[model samples]
Target: MEVSMFGGLVLVMVLVVVVVPALLVGLVLWLVSRSTSDDGGAPARAARRHELLVSSVAVLAAVVCTVVLLAQPVAWPGWASAPGVLQAITPFSVALVLCVVRAVGEQTWPRPRGEVRSAPLARRTIWSLGGARLRIVLVTAAALAVALVVFGATADPTGRAFATNPVTLPDGSVVSGASGPYPGWPYGLPMLLGLALAVAATFVALGSITRRPPLHGVPARHDDAVRATSAARLLGAVQLCLGVGLGGALAVGGAAIQSRGQNLLLDELPTHGLVAVGGGVALLGIAVVVASGIAGLLAAWPRAARHAGAPAATGAPA
Candidate 1:
């Protein structure tokens, strides 16, 4: 079955519009049910209230994205395709930005599971390779390198499509049937930029999450909770952004191929299967965002439960 670029765009529309709302609804309902089951007579606390507000915002964004997505494919005179992607990304992007900002003000390091006082992880934190910090950096760098290979270095040099150039048929006639695009010195630069930005964001977020207090004693349980939430939320944001950047590059690249093909009046475009690849990336990113959010919340719910019952922190006199 031959799928066109337009068809893939609509499929992405369904992903962002239909699937997002369904996921949000299911998540909200699940949280409500879990809370009710856990504490049948308890009143909602500040954390629960905050989560509901965030859910409401997410649902609102999903509805707006639905309208924009539905309008995009039809090119409803006033609705432009470019805005569809931007709109879909805005809510997620904003949420992530808030996460990072909040991280900025977080405690320099976590307290021991049982101790009350807090201090820095070390005299100078930069050289500390302990925990997930170095791992996050290495993984992010590896991911960027892979993206560069797949999207940039391998791009077709002729600037027509990725890894494609003109070919001579048996009839001795030349055709632009190359499977890739023409490349240039600056080719695929935007993809690299997008990847770099995502990597940078991931690094900063991971650094904040991995600042552990000296680890001896019962503090380990709380440390595990911190790491679980951090991994879920930070990794989710990273993957979401990475997926968007890669998917956007593929979509734009596919459009370029269609344009070149039409201009050349070719029967087939250079990048025949590009749309499917882009759609897949978009879906992966959407899945990561939803999954990570749920995981982060679940990881922290127990911590919140403990906090709800424990006495408030009070500093002892020197």
Candidate 2:
């Protein structure tokens, strides 16, 4: 029954991560294509086409990476083995890579031939590109990562099963809920490294986006919108990844605590607090998972950046 339930959960996740986004992207692209087709301006049409092409490629690459990661067999040591590690890392890795690809693609935006091009005098920064939403997401992810590391470090080293407080019974036998799996250095180390790499990749991608030349033949507002959209997407991806990881960690830790409470010996100990604590943690984890799914959806939806009345570029020749 547990296996079946887990399988069902996996199916739901696959649908969320893969099928839903693909359909939405296809629908959006079709609508955009139709709208662009009816317009008769060459420059506008070209800009839209270039945007579509780059977006499609980036989405495709991210989806392909996700599939490969999910399907590949990996052997990881510790309680949270290959599946756990992959679950925690895949979202962030795929999203970060997608951002990088899109940033690189933006650099290649076509310029009009035999025409003078203008550059913006205002310098672009990561903060300017992403706005408040980006900062909030980044700070949240960083906090979660830190918490996970601290929890892992403090946990007793259990190999495969959850570490529980040892209990002594009147029968002169000592028992524990489980043994062998604790989020110790072994588990924490790899996750920390992966997160660090993800942060580095995110900065690199954002830097690329900020530094890329403005799109020519498009209105200044159009160029701002494009950059803002890209930043929003990156922020969404980052939020999704970290949120999922934090949720999973909470769920696992809660399960460990609940297992201890469920031990038959605990029934006679006159204390049932662990059960309540565990349940609360588990519920919070579930909530986080749901929120992460929403974040993923938001990331998939394209939108222009919401700048607070920033002046449009004057299109002065560089």
Candidate 3:
């Protein structure tokens, strides 16, 4: 299928902006958690089941959402269908983000000696990854919001027409064909930018997670791991962005092919596909954002939970 440059750009945006960062954050936190354990400086095998459970749930939700949205293929759907996706997965996203954040932070930060406060394995692992994850996510959201606004301003507002002209074939058969103004780069550029920002954010987030210990932990040397992860994330983000752009271009080209084959909405297909895919990308973006926010929260959760339940920390000597 031929892909227009514009459509390809959309695909690039999705990859760079949405998926890579989440994976990076997740991996970093998992590593950090594994590196540090109470019994030994190695990750506890016991936490594997719980970690898998959270990750499984998140992936399942994403898959279900993709299927549902694709299957339903909203005709005049409500304002981009984000509200629906968010409502369905917010809880799961929130939980995962929190877990990752706490886990990552605990492992990375320099903890005070003798201040080894015990925390649930799930909490530790999740929060350790969560802090950086949350920041990346917020940035992704802001970027997406800006992209949407730009797309709105530049999108083909006339939209696809329900009724179309019929094409006459040599065999004297008539087929329905729909035509509309080209979906131009103006709309696609914001998406591209959003995707770029998302990718860049992911790379930075990974760096934050792996490069140094968390804000509050015993410092351990993971410089090599940190550098490696950061580099990988950066490269991955760029690849994803390229994918987004390329993917969109292909879809559009596909639409063109289909249109040529028969009277179909070829002109509109690629752009529409990008828009739809963009929503999916946004979902991934949200996951990243949610992860980051929860991490930040996890960094604070232990103290917050304790403070809420116990007496305040006092300046006076005990």
Report every candidate's CA lDDT: 0.41, 0.61, 0.35
Task: Give per-residue lDDT, candidate 1, residue 181.
Answer: 25
Better of 1 and 2 by lDDT: 2
Error of 2 at 275 (Å): 2.5
Please name the candidate that would achieve the greatest TM-score relative to the true structure: 2
lDDT of 2: 0.61
Candidate 3 ranges with C-alpha deviation above 4 Å = 1-73, 76-190, 214-223, 230-245, 261-318
Q: Which lDDT tens digits does candidate 1 get at residues 1-318?
A: 112343355456446534564465547545764564323122223223433344344434544554454444322234222223333333234334534543553343324355444533223232232234345434544654464466545455543254346667677888764433222223344344434554565556556645534333323223333344334444443443344433444444444444444544454434455455544544554454454344323322322223434432222111
Clashes of 1: 15
* lDDT minimum window of 10 residues, candidate 2: 1-10
- Candidate 1 at residue 92, lDDT? 36
**Tens digits of per-residue lDDT for model 2 on 1-318?**
322333344335645745466567657775756764423246546666666677678777877777776654434345544334554466566767777787788678765444445556465678877778677677756766775776575566542245556668799888665522233455556566767777777778777767656566655555665666666666666666666556655665665566666663345653357677766876886687678667756655544423436676324223
Sorting all predicted structures by TM-score, with the top scorer first, yields 2, 1, 3
Clashes of each: 15, 6, 62
| Candidate 3 local lDDT, 1-318, one digit each (tens) | 112332343334433434444455456556654564333123212323233334434433433433343333222245432212222222223223333342344243333344432332222222244345434444444544454444334334332212234556677887654322222343244344544454444444444443332222212222222223332333333333233333333333333323433334343222334434434544554454344334432331111012223332111111
